[model samples]
Every structure is written in structure tokens, then in C-alpha cells.
Target: MDQLLAQLPPSVVALLDKWDSNVLLITIASFLAWLVWKVIYNRLEILTQKTRFHWDDLILASVSAPISALIWCWPATISLGFILEDYTQSKLDWLSTLKLMLVIGIFVWITMRLVTNIEDYALTQKNRDETTVQAVAKVARLFFIVIGALTIMQSFGLSLSGLLTFGGVGGLIVGLAAKDLLSNFFGGLMIYFDRPFKVGDWVRSPDREIEGTVERIGWRMTIIRTFDKRPLYVPNSVFSSIVVENPSRMLNRRIYETIGVRYDDSQQVSLIVEDIRSMLESHPDIDAKQTLIVNFNGFGPSSLNIMVYTFTKTVNWVRYHKVKQDVLLKIMQIIDNREAQIAFPTQTIKLDLENAGEFAGMQPQTEHQQ
Candidate 1:
């Protein structure tokens, strides 16, 4: 290789001898590196546009690999000493250090970029479940960071075992600092694997009273959008531990109503219950398969309480409300026709005092002059 290098034309050799110190060489090298990267990356971008695969688009969108390659090639042209070494000892040492830094930078940059590409690809696979994708992405990122850090350390001539020993202590401290965060993370994983609730589920937790649609299942918490347009973020750990009531998942909805009748109107109570049952059975929305129960539940202080239990054909809230409204209107009409009134809580109090007389003889009680 040395003989071949020496055998070149005088002008070419002269140019190479000057290559080490010539500012023009540095500029040309930079321009060529940039030109190569531009051409290759643009071609990738064009290819991405022509293809229909989203994964390919993601790969093209992150052009870090090409950029890393261009960066790695730059110092090789001037720093190998054989290529061009004209500087004094101090300048050469500086150049060497710069080259080493560049090498470390390229190593870390490429590793992270490739990791990003893999994560993007993993996200594109719809066959993989959402929880799997999240876990994979997290694991991939951690792996990339560790590899990058180790590569940089090794480039500086440091042993990885020493770093790992230090890292063990550091990791312990970090774990202690983030105990709750880790708990939430693992809780989220359990929730995902257990399949207790999914996106778009309506869940009610003992700690939280949520009546809304699920918007997202994130790493530490689940987001629910309430009916009032407010967003609630409940920790996944709480959801995993608590009882979750999913109204949407119910097969059929039970409609229970308590209607009261005046105590004196006892004779009409049975007739009203029978009429209500008939109305429920004849209603278009009632599920006939479900057993309907109508009974005199109990007697209140001022009224007879009747329980009407029936199931609606559908579980949708709006439809259930419509059916319930119709039934309620019919019950009111029947009560009006029978001239019976719905009872309210009532109490009568009698005030009697021994010798019921006003203070200081202002007035005196008189029970038929007794």
C-alpha cells in the first residue's frame, strides 16, 4: 500500500502532501460528505413517498443512520495520520482527540438511531397488542441507552464492569427515589395483561367515581373523558386494585323505580301495580325474556312504597331513558285517573304542657274549664 501510494503522479502526490494542512481539503471533504448524505437521504425520502407501508415511511422519516455514516467518514479522511499528517505534536494530539470524540459520537448516534427505527417498526405491527408494543419500546430504549453509554465509556478506555458496579448503587438510589412511580408502572403492566379494562370502557373505581368513556391507557394511568367534558386520570394501580364497574359492558340494564301511594289510598295500590306491570309488558322496549317483578316493597311513614323491577331490551343509556320516560308518564296518567295522590313524607306534632299557662300568668290553659 505504501509503494502504491508512492507511485502516484507527482502532482497528485504533491496534492496529498499538502492534503494534511490545506484548508481547501477540509472544505472539499465536508462538501462531499454532505453531498453524499443529501443524495442518499433524498432517494430514501422519494422511495418512502412511493411506498404505501407506514413502516417504510417511518424508516425514511428518521434519516439518522445516513447522517451517522457521513459523520463517521469525515475524520477518517484527515485523522488516520497515513492519509495526511502534517501538523506539529500539539496540533496532532488535538486532532487525535477530536477524532476520538467523533468516533464515540458516531457510535452512540448510530446505536440510538437504529433503536429508534426498531421501535417505530414495532409500533407499526397491528397484530401485536398495545401493551406489548409499549413494553417493547420501553425495553428497546433502555437497551439503546445502556449500549450507547457503554460504547462511549469503552471508547475512553474505561472498563464496563467498573461502571456497572457504580451503576448498581446509583440504580438503587434511583429506585428508592421513584418507588411510587415504579409501582404505578408495574401496576399498569398488570392491568394490561389482566385485561380488566380497555380503551373506551366505562369504569368506576372505589376511589374514583368515573362515568365516562376511556380515552387512553397510558404507562402509569388511564385517561377517562367524563360526560361533562372533563378528563380524569386515574392511576393504573388504583384501577387494578379497586372494583371497576363497567356500565357499557352490561348485557341488559335493570330499571328499578320506587313509586309511593297515599296511605289512605291503600285499595288502589294493587290496581296501580298491576297496571304498571301491564304497561311494562306491553311496552316495545321491555325485554320479555327478563323476569319483571312488581311488589309492595314496604310501608313508609306516610305512604306505601312499591318496587317496579324490569329490564330494558337495550343497554344504551339514551334508549333506556326513553323507555323509562314512557313508563313514568303512563304511571302518572293512571294515578290521576284513579284520583290517588303520591305521598310525601309527613309528620304531625302535638304541643301539650301541664297546666299549659303563659309565663307570669299572661295566659292560662283551659280544657273545658278543667
Candidate 2:
């Protein structure tokens, strides 16, 4: 190792020999880069408080520029190869091999940083979806990985065309072996194009009804966070196949209820219907342009039933519930004011034998007295 170290040229030796060794130069370079990066970062962090454009802030927050500078460390290591190569040709090959690996690693790391930057930028948009952003970012990262792999192979003097051809044939065999996985991957693509539901959407399927906000869209799965703070992960293929009702997409939802009136209070049915229609028309949230209906549904065993139905203009569930509640309270007050009774099941019976026996026992004495 000492001979190997000695074989290096004086210029290389001088740089390496400084202070203690070449390690000190590496330390100095690293410290300088770090110092500049930190200074710039502190300035950016201070400026972030004043700026409204958050993506630029994200660029600083993520330290993308710093990450770039850190990647420069690999090239500095590779530069040693150039200096050492002049000393020994065999050492040159070894350095070259090491340089190739470092280059690929740096490329992948930078690619990941770029993906994160894009994802962060997407998150700042008002209408942008977090799921779609992450999905696309992952796709971009995967693309970079494939390219980096090919480049690494090419750097080693591998046949690019032959490798691609072999990969294509091997990919077919691997794909067939994992058909279900591929189905899910393509299903994710379909979801991106079709857009049946988006982030923060509340959806219900036939077997499961859950109110959730979409968290992420992965190649094989979609993640949702429910109102209860639980995460629900469903496969993309399953989501594509199932029938999902997106409540958030609806402009309005119909409210339906039944109110019962007493059999003796049947005369008030038409009046009640008229009052309900008036109530719906006067209500601020109810959609006046749509049909507001109250009709005599049928007679129950003990009461006359009326069906009341209306639609509210707003899609917000909480607001819709409040409006329906207010309408119900007003209708109950109207029923009370009209002096009509709400009916419940009751039984009436007549007694005949007991009264006859008491009168029969007293009839003979009354006849004698007469």
C-alpha cells in the first residue's frame, strides 16, 4: 500500500501530503461546500417568510441546490483517479470502475431530489391532487432509475442494444409471472386518465361506505385517510372494478321523510301539504327551482301518512343536515298550531254481559214495587 501510495506523482502527492494527507484536502472541500450551502440556506429561510410563491420556498426548504453541491463530492473523488492514472495504468482502470459506480449513484440521488422538488411544488397548488402528484413523481423516479441502469452498463462497455433486447425478452417472462401486479399498475394508469375520484373526495361502494380523503395514488394501490383518522388502502385494480359513489361530486342530494297524522285529523292533509310546499319555498337552502313535494302516501293502521321530499342546492353534508333539521322543526310547529293529533295504535272494546246481569237482578224488585 505504501509503494502504491508512493507510485503517485509529486503533484498528486503534494495535494495529498498537505497538512497530514490528501484526506485534509477532501475535508477542506467538504467544509467549504457545506459552509456556502448553509449560508445560502439561512438566507433563503429568512426570505421564505416574506414570499408568497411557496414552490421557491420548497426549493430552498428541500435544499436542492445544496444537494447538487453535495453530489459534486463524487466528481472530486473521481478527479483523484485522473491524477493517480498518470502513475499507473492498472490503477487507472480501477479508478475508472469506481468512478462509474459513483457517477450512477450521484445521478440516482439527484434524480430523487428532482422528483421531490416536483412533488413539493405540486402540493402547493390549490386544485392539485397529492395522490396524482406522488404517483407521477414515482413514475419519474422509476424512469430515471431505468436510464441510470442502462447508462451504468454502457459505461462498463456493455452492449446497449443486446442488453435492451435481452431485457425486453426477460421483461415478458417476468411480466407474465406477475400478471396481477401488472394489472394493478395499468389500473393506476386508467385511474389517472379516467379520474373517477380525486384527492379529498368522499366515496362509497356497495359493500363498504367510508368517508375518506385520498392520500396517495401508487402504481398498485390507492391510500385514503378516513374521517376517523384511519388509513384505508385499496388496490387500484379493485377500485377500477368496483362501483363507487362519489358524494362530493353531486351538486345536491334529496331529503325524504314521512310524517303521520291521526285518522280523525285527516281533513288537514291537503292543508299540511300546502304548508310544507310553502315552507320549502321560503327556506333559503332549499332549491326552489326543483320540485318540492308533499303528498298523501297512504293510510297506516292508526294514522294517515304523508311523504315529504325536497332537494337542497348545496352539496355540503353538514349544511344540508342543518337545513333539513330547521325544516323539520318548522313543520312540527305548524302541526301543533293546527290542533291536529299525531296518531298511535290504540284499542277500544265494549262490555255487554256484566251490565245485563246487574240490571236483571234489580228488575224483579222494581216490578213488585210498581
Candidate 3:
């Protein structure tokens, strides 16, 4: 690189040094680097578009400017150091450290940018979960940042061995002081790995009153959008201790309801049950492969209870309700066709032999009082 710089024409060097314009040199170098990176990135972008994979595009895009900046920085810093040493007769000792830090920072920035691009691309895929992609990206960024920080510290003459020992002790103390916060963070990691539920899932806990659609799952807490439209903030650690039911993952929505018919319609019970079973089996929305039970559940005081247990093909809430409504209406129509009605409570009154005469005498008086 020094040889290449020396190979420059005397005319150009003289032009640059006429007014000792170091700022102009840096500006011109920056512009040339930008133009070169722009051209390289454009070419890489076209090539990536032709390739079968997309990740290469992300890598190329992420590394382009950072690499160009690195290329520009090496010579720029060396030139500045030379220029300053000639004028001041001493080198800026910290300039070397600054360059080291800059290199480390640029690499970290590149990795983090690449992670972000991958995260966004994953989100664009229909099957990818937004929460999982974001979590993975965050972990990647954190890893790069930690590495960069340690590298920078090493550049500054800090002993990594001493730092590690101090960090271990300090980490232990911090852990003991913030147990709950750490627990929540680990719980979040567990959530990401186990995937009991993700953002936008309908999760309900039998152990606690946490029933809602998960809006956001963070390191410390999860934000739930309850059915009542209120936001419920739950610590992630609570999920570790409780049982969460993810209704969104269910393949079929169950329709378990007990329909009642008048006792007078007992003769029609067999036909009604058979017809309901047939209707559910042939229904497009119902999943016949699942448990489809339609039978007389019990004998009520005034009506006969017929339990219908079945599953719908769709797990969507709105569509499930519509299907349930249609099934119920069909059942009602079948009952009406059989000349049977939905039963209502009824009672019959009777009088004893001794009270008959008293009632006969009181009947006229009660009627007159009314």
C-alpha cells in the first residue's frame, strides 16, 4: 500500500500539498470509497438476484460499506499519523488504539447488520414466526457486541484474564441481587426454544388468570391483549411455573353442546340422534375423523338431553362460531321436522282428599277476592 501511494504522480502529490489540504484529501478519499463500494454492491446485488439463495445478498450488502470504510481508514489514519508526526515531531499514541477499536466496531456492525437483514427476510416468509426470528437476531447481535467489547478492551491494554475473573465474581453478585429479573430472562429463552406459544397466539393458563392473545413476548415480560381489549403484562417467569394452553395450535375446534327435547318427543329421539350424527359426518366444516358423538346424554326433569360432541376442521375463532351456528340450526330444523320442540320447565299441581272440600269452599271465595 505504501509503494502504491508512492507510485502517485508528482503532479498530483504537488497539487494536493500546495495548500496542505489534509481535509480535502480525506473528503476526496471518502467520496471515492463510497463510489467504489456503490459499484461493487450493485454488481453483487445483480449476481445475488441470479443465484438460487438470498443469504449471500445479505452478506454482501452488510459487508460492502463496512469493508470499504475499513479500507479507507487504514491509509487515512496512517497518512494522518505521518503528517502529524512530521509537523509535531511526535505520534498520537492513542491513534493506534482508535484504529483497532474502529476495526472491531466495523466487524461487529457488519455482523449485526447481517443478522438484522436475515431477521427481516425470515419474517417475510409465510411460515416464520416474527417472535422467534427477532429473538434469534437479538441473541446474535448480543454475541457480536460482547466479542467486540472484549476486543476493544484488549486493544486498550486490559488483561482479559483479570477481566474474566472480575466478571465472574461480579456476575455472581448481580445474579443473587436480581434473581427474578434473571429468571424472567431465562424463561423468555425457554419460551423461544419450547415454543409453547408465540406472539399472536391465543394462550390461556389454567393456573392463573392469564387468558388472552399474546401481543409481544419480551425478555422480562410478555404483553397480552385480553379479550376485553385491555393489555395484561405478565412476567415471563410466570409461564415457566404455569400451564399454558395454546388454542391457536389446535387442529380442530370442538363443538360440545347438550341439546334438549320435550319428554313427549321421546319416540323421536332415535331418529333425531341418527340424523344429527349423519349431518355432522357429512358437514364440510366438521372433521369426521375426530370424535363425533351424538347420543342421549341423560333424562332431565322435563326434557331429554342429547349431547353433541364433535370437532370442526378450522381452528379460527370466527369461522368456528359460524360453523357451530349452522350445525345448531340444522339440528333445530330436524327436530321441527320430527314435530318435536325444545323443552321448557313445567309442573303439575294436585290436591289431597281432605283438602278437596276446603279447596272447593275456598275456590269461590278466592275467585271473588281476585
Score candidate 1 by TM-score against the native: 0.60
Sorted by lDDT (best first), the order is 3, 2, 1
TM-scores, one per candidate: 0.60, 0.75, 0.86
| Better candidate number, 1 or 3, judged by lDDT | 3
Candidate 1, which ten residues in sequence have the lowest lDDT sum?
Answer: 82-91
- For residues 1-370, what per-residue lDDT tens digits would candidate 3 score against the true structure? 6676588998776766653346566657766877887887888889899999988988997898788878777757767876887789885898888788888888898998899889889989989888889788889988999999999999999999999999999999999999999999999999988999888899999999989999998989999999999999999999889999999999999999999999989999999999999999999999999999999999998889999999999999999999999999999999999999988898868859988898799989999999
Instruction: Tally clashing residue pairs in candidate 1.
Output: 0
Tell me the TM-score of model 3.
0.86
Ranking by TM-score: 3, 2, 1
lDDT of each: 0.75, 0.78, 0.89
Residue 113 deviation, candidate 2, in Å? 1.8
Which has the greatest lDDT?
Answer: 3
What are the candidates' C-alpha RMSDs? 7.4, 7.3, 4.3
Candidate 1: tens digits of C-alpha lDDT, residues 1-370: 7798789998888887877556567657667777787788788888878877776676555555646465546545464554334433333444555566566666556555666676667656776565456556666667767776677677767888898899899989988999878878888778777767666677675555766888777778878998898998877777656777878778888988898999888999999888888888888888867989888899888889989899998888898898888888888898778889888999879866754555426434454357
Number of colliding residue pairs in model 2: 1
Lowest lDDT sum, 10 consecutive residues, model 2, at: 18-27
